[model samples]
Target: MGGEWFEVLRPPYLPVEIRWERAVADGLPADVSHAFGIFDTTLCGVQEAGMSPSDHWWLPERESACDACREAAGVIDDRRPRAMRGEDARVSVARRL
Candidate 1:
């Protein structure tokens, strides 16, 4: 049988079932719980959503997203060009110095 597949990600400190609450506690608008279903599939359906290794989902359009996630996305976005040039390691390290 074929079935649609989905992914859900949540921080470890928060119960997986109450991930939405964690989003709210983190200062994101409460409506976010409804804006995107509390899963990566629905989260990615929202424009410009980002998933982190720590199992957090962020909407890139929202200024209210977790700072570290947004900044991490920004760092990755900033590196795309250097990566395309085949010099990501050198440039990424140089930028940190």
Candidate 2:
């Protein structure tokens, strides 16, 4: 129920599930996942803390929880890190000095 918004944001070639996996595989930009996670957590509370959508917003389909996970996730502050210069960071083989 909470992922309704996500249903519309379909990317061509990659299905939603695959895209999510790709994001994980490619190491998605932290800010993008972090912020979105916060919003999503707010809608569907965490289980470890005994929180669920029914706890506050009345999700209609799920049971109540102790507290929402979004609260724990906190708000997003988008200040992306800058790219490193000089060398290719991912080069596995060490270069000869």
Candidate 3:
């Protein structure tokens, strides 16, 4: 019954989408199909049954997200290109590690 919502700022496929995930019980679902179905069901639900307080229609309060989510956002933000011509691309990738 107890679970935690973690924000995924930079999913591998879509870097710009703000996504949230629920890690309940032991951990997240290992199967992609299960994960997708679970997430979709929760998100598509009405009345915000299992949704987080910050989970609005379009605006989510990232600052209020859990520490893990915040950290992920930071990591993603850093890796994203900061300039048009990749001026900041020269930055060492090791920083992410």
Pairs of colliding residues, candidate 1: none
Question: Best lDDT goes to which candidate?
Answer: 1
TM-score of 3: 0.27
Report the C-alpha lDDT of model 1 over 62-96, residue by residue, as the tens digit. Answer: 65554444444455455444324332223122233
Query: Which portions of model 2 show Cα errors greater than 4 Å?
Result: 1-40, 43-79, 84-93
Q: What are the clashing pairs of model 2?
A: 50-66, 52-65
Local error of candidate 1 at 60, Å?
2.1
Question: What are the models' TM-scores?
Answer: 0.26, 0.15, 0.27
Q: Select the stronger candidate by TM-score from 2 and 3.
A: 3
Worst 10 residues of 3 by lDDT: 28-37
List the candidate 1 regions with Cα displacement exceeding 4 Å. Answer: 1-57, 82-97
Clash pairs of candidate 3? none
Please report how far candidate 3 places residue 15 from its true position, in Å.
11
For candidate 2, report its TM-score. 0.15
Top TM-score: which candidate number? 3
Tens digits of lDDT, candidate 3, 10-40: 2233232344443222233323211111432
lDDT of the structure predicted as candidate 1: 0.36
Candidate 1: lDDT of 57? Answer: 42
RMSD list, candidates in order? 15.8, 16.9, 15.5
